[model samples]
Target chain A: MKRRTVGRSDGRKVIVAAVLVSLLSFGPTVRRSDGQDTSAIDRGVRIGIIYRPGVRPGLVMLPRTGQGLDSVRVIVARDLDYGDRFEVITLPGGDSIRLASTTGPRRSSAGGSTATKGATAGALNYPLYQALGADFALDITAAGDTTVATLHDIAAASVRRSVRVQLPRSSDPDFRQAVHRLADQALQAAIGTPGIAATRILFVKDGKVYRIDQDGADQKLVSSTDRQAMSPAWGADGRRFAYMEFQAGKGWLYLQEMGSGKRTAVATTGSALDFTPAFSPDGQTMAFSRATEEGTDLYTINIKNNCCLRRLTVGRFSDNLSPTFSPDGQRIAFVSTRPGLPQIYVMAADGTDQQLFAPFDYGVTGASNAPEWSPDGQSVAFHRDVAGTLQVFVLDVRTRTVRQLTSVGRNEDPTWAPDSRHLAFVSDRSGYRQLWIIDLDTGRIRPLLQQSGARLPAWSPRLSEATSSTP
Target chain B: MKSVSLLLALGLGAAVFAAASCGGNPAPQNTTPAVDTAAENQRVRDSIAAAEAERARQAQAEAERIAAQRRADSLAALARAGEEVRSTLAAMIHFDLDKSNIRPEDAATLDQKVAILQANPELRIRIGGHCDERGSDEYNLALGNRRAQSGKQYLVSHGIDASRIETQSWGEEKPLVDGHDESAWSQNRRDEFEIISGGDNIRRP
Candidate 1:
């Protein structure tokens, strides 16, 4: 039985294993091609720790040479670090390079050679950084409202990729965003997957909806102050999102377009309460919960035409809410109280084959709710009221096995990133309510936002590629 | 001049007669009646002055009585409002673990809310649903909705107009208690009635 299980698990991770195998070979081949250190394999292992459980790509950021782009360099470094797919390394006082004065007095070329004078502080010391053991080193140069990023494979001793991005000098936000895009492109060249550093997380803080950058910068209020907003769900188009707002003691589902900042409330019949709106992957349909005098149940609305309203669940007196759709838009997992307690349930997009999903005893594992289907559709993450407190748990859809992800404080409202490798949830483990992210591969958990009182985080799809402003 | 002298002589004869009478001690019987009449007039004037003072005092007491009655009516109105709030508070219905059905023990409370609504015809209330902080936020919201709907249904069954009652689910956001135990959970999972309109119409019996 153990052998069979091992084989099945290995088979599921064939793609990840293949990538690791190729990376391991690439390092040695690059060394051989350079003829610099044939016996340096052992040194490579000693200098830099590599091959983690799931290998996070290693990157080193070199000192930047620019005029008035010190802030841009910091933005790029921070973006790459927050990507979570890379192991970013910075030299001692290396981060201060971005904070240093870009307009200081120049060195006197009369005292020495011009080349020596120009190489005073911000020159690339390749050998020293190469020994520091990074797979790739990134060099950024800013000149006249444009920045160029060059990724050099350290072992191969060759330039892997170079990308030049033009930024608007009038706006600091646009310039920083351009730098983020540059860093993402460099990471994509090193690894096959692009970074989500340019994306935004929409959440509710202090009863108002807000949007913040992935690195917790530039926090902006997105919803109206007249009402309390909750459960923000980003649309696939990256420009639109839907949230639940309470006005005049009634809940209304409103869709907000970020470009125009125009909010339109969904038109539904009756005075029934509507909330927890989730947009389909294609942004055409929205699945939400409606509580009427009859009961609370899951329903989907055709958001484009504002017409086809279809009820998904038939809970006479029970409640079915918090619907999350699969990446393929074919299945939806939601919380249902039909069996007397809230439990995760999965059904087809058309509301067929509805059945209990998680394997739990009545009072043993507690009740489960807030089901979020991962972008990869392999697992469903939800919080269970277990052992006297709520904890986050991920249930493998194929194996029907559940694993607890959080052990500290009460963790709830787990939402996935675009890569499906990380999740942002709410935890009071730090003695206050705050947003936290847990990397599944590395088993590393960190606070996402420095400002507290954040909840119900919904990550937007790769906004760098989808947003018009990003180049 | 002769007519005038004749008239003056008659006046002088009357005056001499009056002066002779007033001066003579033997005329005491005639002067005694005049003295009695003067005393009678002074006594009548004193009686009129006392009657006027009594009328003024009566008017002042009547004004004070009216002002006191007005203050008492205002206090009674305030007490009526307080009683309305107390009745609605007493009508708070709590739920078991995850169940939304109205409990039998809470039926009397719901009945009280229904009575309050029935008494004040224009009064409208919002049934706010709540939950213990032990579940997902979105799920708790749905559970709260069910709990509130259950409370509203009970009120409707007890002859309250459905239009007069609205429902809101706070989920676990607004908690009556904050402790992480059954005691707090029990109090937290309750439906509270908030008077949204027509509060002024709540009158005391």
Candidate 2:
């Protein structure tokens, strides 16, 4: 990872502090050098050169040659498209675009051109791709645990990059996960950002934690017991989750391991109501809300042994809770009722310099809560009370401009996908509360589950192949 | 019989008086012959008419005063009822969307709860905080807890014991209304009170 220079402006420093705190804060805040006016910086952040919605790059997927590679093609195509950075063109009538015919098994160490000769020459057909309005083409070849992905820049008539990875074995239960890793690599090769298809979304439904794939497949009930659960949070390691459970007439925070289904109940004051647990980006510290007679405030606990308990917010009269760390773990955006209503507030990780975020109308826009920092550290998405219904809104931390995302029904609890362009939220637009995903750039909203009664979705970071191998 | 002097003047004078009086009272149900009888009859009729008009004016003023007093009384009674409603245990105070602070409009309602608790020393009450079905469940619980605390704080400040009031948060788990519309959500985001001990034992006579 490359580090950018921090400009002298206060807002710029704040953005840098936010990004330095976490590069996965959502997306990178607009970098403004010294001597530029605040208005210019605002404009630059909103209309930045990278990740513009309208000028999406066009890419095409070619047919793969191997057994047990059907799932890989489907996963990669959908994952790349879901990133909202590419226009993936498939052959007419939904047929796979065949690259070349191959003879028997052939493998080589350098460049691996012996088996891909015909495929390589045919993939450079720029006129065909130009006629189809594709700017790049992808050809994937899989054999056993190894897969090679070649990306061709059609307009440039040259191969852009090739990514080869030893995926999980076809017989392994996590084969789809390995495929997701390859998809992410291919995306990184084509565009600078990796795809989030390999990530999982953790949500609460029926008082339990449920896990689902990024493409809205493989819905699994991860929490085994029937305890009332809330605030499902994913760890940075991608194999652990923490949630608040109501048991024995008290609120308890439980940390669950994905592989073994083992859970450890983190002890807090027996009389205090502890909930809303969020793991830091480094997975070493856990921040949560602890309710006592004084008031509900944010607190952090060491995750290794759960020994170091630290109070983050001092709310003698106000209610401060729901702490989400910036990707760098330097700043936290939480909900505070200090101004007479629950509104989003950003403060340093130690809880100093708490300031109201994105000045919103107290009565008109309602109170903003459940704020999740974007991975790039540019924006924060939260649900505000608009009239009586809750609607999702994204605020550009740099510009202080807000964009409302949902208007119908009641949409809330927005969690950003790893790509930062997409958000998974819980909505009741379909009559019952259910999980829904929206690509902010395209205004495309789809239900993550056909069934209802889902809330509080927490998206996982991009799942590395090493983590997936634990299963 | 009557004797006339200066006949031309007498005829004009009599006709002028009768016309000016516009059918003046016909001698007030009495017959008497006097030199200035027509003038006397006109003067008596004018006095009686003036007395009647004054009486009607006084009657109208009295009615208006009575109506004004009634309006003021009615308004005072309504105000008292509103205050009573605010302090009642049945009244549920609503908060702003994500707010736990008692809204100014709801302060009177919580004050009503405080008053009820003050009046009934043996009364133990529970305040349950709730949220609309919009936010994350645990945060809602935390929000709900704050809301309940806000109400409890108001009660304590008003001289109620903290132990007399227990707080719980249902969050969005329980809703007063089922619909997803604003009408339902606004109703759901509220602090409701339940009498835990006292009201059951006391019998109102």
Candidate 3:
């Protein structure tokens, strides 16, 4: 069946309902409370000390000579901070630093302290670094028309033997891909794991579902029909998914088996409206939004036994929608308008302990819905309509810091891949709605799919060992 | 009983008319011979044949009237069924853009739906949720599921058993309207209801 576009007025009503439900539960004074500590702490690597006392890991950013230095610097700092790998420091000149002078730890200033001259070619200042607890330093060089990145092992007092490659020119249309590749390589060198730069994202576009590589290649449509199919949620194993389909004037939930291309309906209640399905970390249960005349609420249903169903929320004053499960499956993130505007909210998996996650600012009175959790359970990605433009944003759960992702066009329905290194979202930058992917480390965006119109993408979890063996 | 009396009255009227047609003058009681008696017998046989032909004509008219009435009833039923389908479509819940959540105002319609399901025990229905022309294909597929689930939940809450309902989300794959504007979008975001069993013979209206 062919899918149809929803009318704007009706869409607005839905937006209003979703926002109202999210705000109602938060109550008035949706602002961040004084007791709320919005701090970015408790962040560190989990690796054991594998390095000799002198060996250290650091991140470097190099800009092409012709590029804007300030822009490059700012972007590099943001990317590094986002990667959560290093604390950034500023150097005075391109060639004046002596490596020896900064061997020891030094206090980092609020805005970033300028490096002193003659700090290059350093000898071991072990006590100084040990005192500052500085593990590594990043050095960036833009020479001639090319940029070169060098990783310096502060502890070992040795540079990485492999020479870093220059990213493709900024003028190149595929510069985004080049940047992503660079970031991926840097991450791999530092962390010993492949980055999300090469992963692909799947999302709905123009009433059709599509998939594209992380670098925005190999776009293809998964389904072509006239009915509205939305909210793609991946199972724990990543091989299968549960999505909604409306065909022949009926609504149903279909379990799509990726490899076999076969779909089966899980349940069909012909009366109420059901959507926004999220799979548990174990893939045994699914949570979704159930809407009726009284108001929209959240519900959970077990996949194994069709009879095991539970309603998570109940009320007439607020309409709750877009229920997303936390990575640990203990909590859920959703959008409610209970407080009179749409804001992100969190609740227990059984629908208790409800609280608002996003601070309601008067400057941005638009709706914030479609909350998706990062694979590591550290952050959540959601879409908020600011001044009538929908933009994607991420919130660090522990830090309570919000970061905006998209600036141009209307972007909404953001989902994270299992690695938590990238995000797949819907954008209308190409004159029509299409699916796009963003590399978290590089902050570069690429079109994931060429769908003329699409929205709502759910990234599947990595395949489980048991499932892979059975297959 | 009234119809039978009316039929009897018509028969008496026909007999009276036949008597009036006979001449008032009476023939001598014993006069005339065997030739006269034979002539009288021929006249009586002719009158009986004419009466039988008149009754056959009346019966044919009555049969035609009854057949016409049956045809009119059938046509009326068909019209009613068509109206029912239109009304049902109008009463269906309209979904949001890429969302399957049912709006609060649609509750009254759902209640009527519960009544429908309760009245038809053997009837089964399929709920279909749809989305507007936005977002990815896969996401819409999921959104469609949400819409269908929303409808199904309402029925279950209203005391209709879940076993009788089936759901399918067509996503953006199926749409009732084709334009890209708000007008088309509103028409596209909707949850459709289909009766799948038992009530096929019932008039739609």
Question: CA lDDT of each candidate?
Answer: 0.73, 0.73, 0.60
Q: List, residue by residue over A1-471, the lDDT tens digit for candidate 1.
A: 000011222332344334333423223222111211111211111112223424655577665444666666677777776675665665323322231122344332221121112342233444434444466777776646567777877667677887787866736545545566777788888886878777788889878888877776777788865577889999987888889877777788988887667888886833577889998998889999988777789899999999889999999867788899988999999888877778899899999999888888875668888888888889999998867678889999999899988877788889888888788888888787788877676555667776677999988887763462522
- Candidate 1's TM-score: 0.79
Shift in Å, residue A226, candidate 1: 2.2
DockQ of each: 0.52, 0.27, 0.05
Q: Give model 3's clash tally.
A: 133
Residues B87-176, model 2: lDDT tens digits: 477689897777777888887777767666776688888888899966656567878887888888899999999999888777887799
A454 Cα displacement, candidate 2 (Å): 1.9
- Best-to-worst TM-score order: 1, 2, 3
lDDT of 2 by residue, A236-327 (tens): 88888998877643568888888778889875633567888888898888999888778789999888877888998989888899899998
TM-score of each: 0.79, 0.67, 0.51
**Best TM-score among the predictions, by candidate number:** 1
Sort all candidates by DockQ, best to worst: 1, 2, 3
